[model samples]
Target: MTINPLEYSAASHPGLMRDNNEDCFLSQPEHGLWLVADGMGGHEAGEVASAIVRDTIERETHENPAISLLDTIQHAHATILKSAAQGIGAPGMGSTVVALKSNSESYQVAWVGDSRAYLWTPSREGGRLERLSTDHSYVQMLVETGVIRAEDAEFHPEKNIITQCLGMQELPQVRVDFVEHQWHKDQWILLCSDGLTDEVNDKTIAQILFESNNCLAAVDQLLHAALTGGGRDNITLQIIESPLRDNPLRKGLWQWVPYLTGKTLVDAWIFGAALASLVSILFYVMYF
Candidate 1:
């Protein structure tokens, strides 16, 4: 059966309080892949760690078109470890990652640490906003065990303390989760760094998505909301809108660019390849 083409947009900002942004994201509609990684450490190490995680996963996915999503994340984890050992960044540098991949019939969402994936679908009563991925953070554990109320989690002092991440001194006891669901009309998927959630509330996020004209506008409004709500940390968001597809292979034409990096449409392989190289060089020179 034919399905509708997927539409997506991504944006990232350094936020008001931070001097550098330690977040990286990917939106490859052609390959049905999207990701958000948030790095944690001092100085430029955090950014380097996140970049390594994002680049590694992108390379692995592009090379083996059929690689398992779970395996791909593990590969990224291994690469991050190697980079840290080489002193590319701080010894404790690490990152949290959330990824989404889909086929014609269904989609897969995976993640480690506190980055999140949310699913929104239209309904007869009103649209629904559901958090598809659970956070691997200390406060999340407290909330799960009834030690704290969900409402209080946001203000908890340990809210930013994630239990698992990409790289650490010991081989990370990565607890990756996978969520699989079939596609439907008017369904949208959101991947974001903790910066967005830490600032904008759930209700505000749903309101913005429902009111926005397109996926791109939704991304813009989401970033605006985070900045307006304090913007204490780096903020990033990627929104994927799947209208019911009526064509074979779900092909469409549009430009996909990483907001922080230079623009290169995903359909243009030559330009995209060169841009990828430039990004690596820029990362090494800027941070190292």
Candidate 2:
């Protein structure tokens, strides 16, 4: 059996403006499955929609490990629609979902509506924070058609108007978008709802991820940043790290050696001597 090497952290918040959280997340590192769902509708209906999406995918993926994530999401979509049709939730209830699946060799991301996925690579690996999924929203359409710049879409008046999502009555079938990439030990994958993106920009998110010592810290910092940014809507996020990579902060310590040594030659010599002694002790302990 191939042992899974994945570490992850997740968080969800109701935000400052909402009374209840209509967001849900799933993290099953052993299964290499992660997901985020943002619900739409008034009252408790939105919560019900998101919960259905979360539960359906979770159950389906667990039952059949080899099932495609695309099919799993489609199953969730049908479940949510059926629930609403059967009056389980309010009429017209729906949800946006973004999911990530990975194995020892590669990763795949799938999404619908404005929920998103991102990849962060460390500086040694070309240092990039990339968005892996596109929004299925009115603003995105406007941006694509050249009616508005991509930057302006964030603040567009109809930015929240999604073109597609799970459980929409008018649509007969949901459309899913997907992307695949080779998995690397030095990279991280992020799945999130629009709440975080609506408040925190991508640059700030990249900085937080870069500075964090581990997946848990990264998730905490990202959640704090979103709440600090006004917390206008329900917020949810997940950060998944590659288990093959050592602690990122430890790997990055060498970059701080010069700063730690200070400006003077004497300081550098002292620091070097201390580092050498520490290494000697570690070597002795290991060898003896």
Candidate 3:
């Protein structure tokens, strides 16, 4: 059977401290594109920077369906720079972006600054949460150079200091880091601003995502977690479920298999035992 249309959910929230949310996200399954942009500057300027990034990508992808994702992001970078130069937002308005684009068989993730992308596979499929993008921040640099442990970088005072982003007047062009992966039926992609990472640890994030019944639930839990964790910055995120179809037998079997205390492995074992018992009964009845 063919894969179904991609499933996705996105949200942006002004945290407990921030009165205004400067973060923005896009979910365009039609164009196979989704992204999160975190704005920086001050007040309205940050909002403008992120909004420009969102609008530019939305418009470009809608107008030119075949445009390269990289070229589209570059176009957004140029637009943001032009807007800042023309005094549209503020003198130093800029934004960090992380985006995902996909085709039928494969997908690509690209980013600048600390906004991140992660891949999650189910336990039955060698479950794990893998970070797909690296941060362009001073702390990240320090971590890379052995100045600090990766775990320590999270709480470091310089963690928020990003090295580059869209619309920086000092740089003529921004570099976008990217990676590609073959699509798998059991994989899910998550894109988020540092707002989520700053408040929630990777281990907690993986737990929430893996335990969630669907993308919407995962988004809700993640947002709630960040807000509870102090919500120091604007929180934004998107979760994209792969389009590939699950095994037909497993999908049908799950319909009658009740969750056993939210433990997937235990529930799976129960399902297998029940199936085997049913098969043995049918064989006995038919033969005797």
Candidate 4:
């Protein structure tokens, strides 16, 4: 019998002040993995970094029945550099990355930059959401060593300056984590960019998920929460599964491979925006 390995669902939102959104998400139910990346460097450069990460790492799932968490992340790093040299987009752009992969019983994670992964579970003494990745940012370092309080991290001048990211350097920073849980319903998992975590702390995030939280609501509420709390940067969020993973079909081959492709009318709007963004980015990157 083909055992259903993992079952999951997820969502993402682009929050305020980005002319072009550079966030990306990938969920492979069959592989029991979900990824969220928040791109920096702006315009087409940011978009390229994020897209390459999502597409490249996800493609590996098609070949292997089970993906090694370490190998997947390292391959993603190489894929991004290869994409840059292939003449698809600008150079020197980079992005923060967080990825989660689960088996039938346990899970593993990898991270870099300020993006994060959180796990919530119930216990005999109740339950809690715990952050599993370390932020590779200047402010995070300060917070770690007791320089700035967590409350003050938002306004730090270096809050947005990530010390390391996927494409910014030849060697990227990565951390691997293994998380254990009962994989039950109402056990929430969160992956968000600095924009979301910058505006909302762990307590606030847990409260929202505890309240009226589903895929669409979580994305909207997180974006609004960030905006209300100052929204200084681009916010991207992906809340996946209640506890595990599930697969969904992808469609794109039938339509114009070179011309036009998408399901809904709103997708056409996104395409138009992408084209406009591509043109503006060409001038901005080339001239300036």
Candidate 5:
């Protein structure tokens, strides 16, 4: 017998008062994975880093859905380094990643840096949202040791100072969690960058999702609330829907981009193939 697919929903918010928004998201049912990346750097470098993370995740695992999560994330890290090597000052750019992989009743999460995933359940106080991913931030360390209250951690001036991120270091240590045993019927998973948590409170977020008709509307309402509350960064979100035999494109469209555009395709192949050859060395020395 075939098992039923699990429900999914997610949202991100950009907080009040910041210039360059640097967040990215992806949701694909074939792979049964979702991700969010929060990037940091000077100029538009933050965006570049975030896009690299998103692109790597989309490209690597989407092709072979049976691979292990650690292997996919490692591939993504390598790709990020390769992308950074193409730029002069990209060494300083980096991003934080949070990912979820689900199969029917159970889900596994992997994270590095400070982006978070939370699971919400019913409570006597009208339901509580439990933070599933721990922040790799300076403030988090302080809070963990009883040096500060959870409430104080929220208002701490150095709360945004995260200790880990993708592309910042050569090999980031990732924390993987198997949230296997605690599955619930109506629980919702929230994946977000710090921007949303920095602005609106958790209770409000829960209310919005609980009252909304569907996942899409829930995301829309979150964006609206964030903007109203004060949007300081770039915001991105994806709502995962149950897997269906909607299209064979689940595995096809992902790799077809190169073949679709002849000129672009030719250019990519030429670049990809020419690199690690005599031509790339000469080009790099002369121009780059």
Candidate 6:
């Protein structure tokens, strides 16, 4: 089967415990690219670095679709390094990036740092979630070496400590991984920051996506799961739903979920509080 044009949705939130949203995302359905980035450094610096990365990817990829995705990411990496060198960005500023790019029949996923991409598809037993990116982080190393179980890595104190990312001068060699998968109907792609995984487990995420009516509701449910489970960091995600080659789902530009209705009053209250928190944090990031 040929690859279908994708229908997509997205959501972002600062979560309850963070004072700023240091995450940024990009959606370019027309060009078949989407991204999620999580930044590190001080609050101000992290936000700036993430935005720079996001904007660079959007600009570079759109200008030349034939340019290699890895080359485009390297351009973003070089941009961040240049900004840091010139003092335009903060010292130690860096970001974790995960992106999905597609052609007419297959998709390529690439990542650096701990942000992730997952694929879900229906099966006779049940729908399944398959993580597409391996993290460049210390805890992940432990899991790889059998020093700890995969499940135990989540509870490890150093789970958030990544081994490599963009914008660090000492680490001249950063590793980026690329994977390719054939597209099919009833398949979904999820790109997200660690914030969502930190709060919601993989099983729960799979269940939510399987149960939801559409990609929009799945994104909402995922965000809700993260916020309600102690949103300790900025949360961001993009969902891409693949349709049949002959029939595609057409959607307008994605909007934040604040206007969604019909949930329990308590669910609405929780979402409202989470959104209010995000707005306040954004202002703090902007002005302070």
Top candidate by TM-score? 3
Model 6, 155: alpha-carbon shift in Å? Answer: 1.2
Error of 5 at 183 (Å): 3.6
What does candidate 2's lDDT look like per residue over 42-88, in tens digits? 77888899899889988988999999999988888888888887889
Q: Which candidate order results from sorting by TM-score in descending order? A: 3, 2, 6, 1, 5, 4
- Model 3 clash pairs are none
Per-candidate TM vs. native? 0.82, 0.86, 0.88, 0.72, 0.73, 0.83
Instruction: Provide the clash count, candidate 1.
Output: 3
Compared with the true structure, the alpha-carbon lDDT of candidate 2 equals: 0.87
lDDT of 3 by residue, 1-288 (tens): 458788888899999998999999998998999999999998999999999999998899999988888888888889998897787999889999999998778999999889999998875333699999999999999999998999899889889999999988888888989999998876789999999999999999999987787889999999999999999999999999888767667766665666665676688888889889999999999999
Q: What lDDT would each prediction earn against the true structure?
A: 0.85, 0.87, 0.90, 0.69, 0.69, 0.85
Deviation in Å, model 3, residue 49 alpha carbon: 0.5
| lDDT, candidate 6, 158-197, per-residue tens | 9999988877667665677899988876689999999999
Each model's backbone clash number? 3, 0, 0, 6, 6, 0
TM-score of 1: 0.82
Model 1, 129-182: lDDT tens digits are: 999999999999999999999999989998999888998667655668989999
> Model 6 off-target regions past 4 Å?
1-4, 245-288
Residue pairs whose backbone atoms clash in candidate 5: 15-230, 15-232, 16-230, 18-232, 21-234, 123-127
User: Tens digit of lDDT per residue, candidate 4, span 1-288?
Assistant: 122444344545555655567888787776777888887667888878888888777887778757676676667767777777787677777777898877655566778777888876532233577888877889888999999998898778887767677775557544443445555544556787777887898888776665533556766676789889887667776766554322222122212223333344455666768879999999999999
Tens digits of per-residue lDDT for model 5, 1-288 = 224475565565444555556787877666778888888886577777877888877787877777776666666666667677877337778888888787765677777777777776642234566778888899999998999988888889999998767776646544433344345544567788877777667778888766664567877887787787777665665544333222334334433334434464565676567555877789889998
Q: What TM-score would candidate 2 get against the native?
A: 0.86
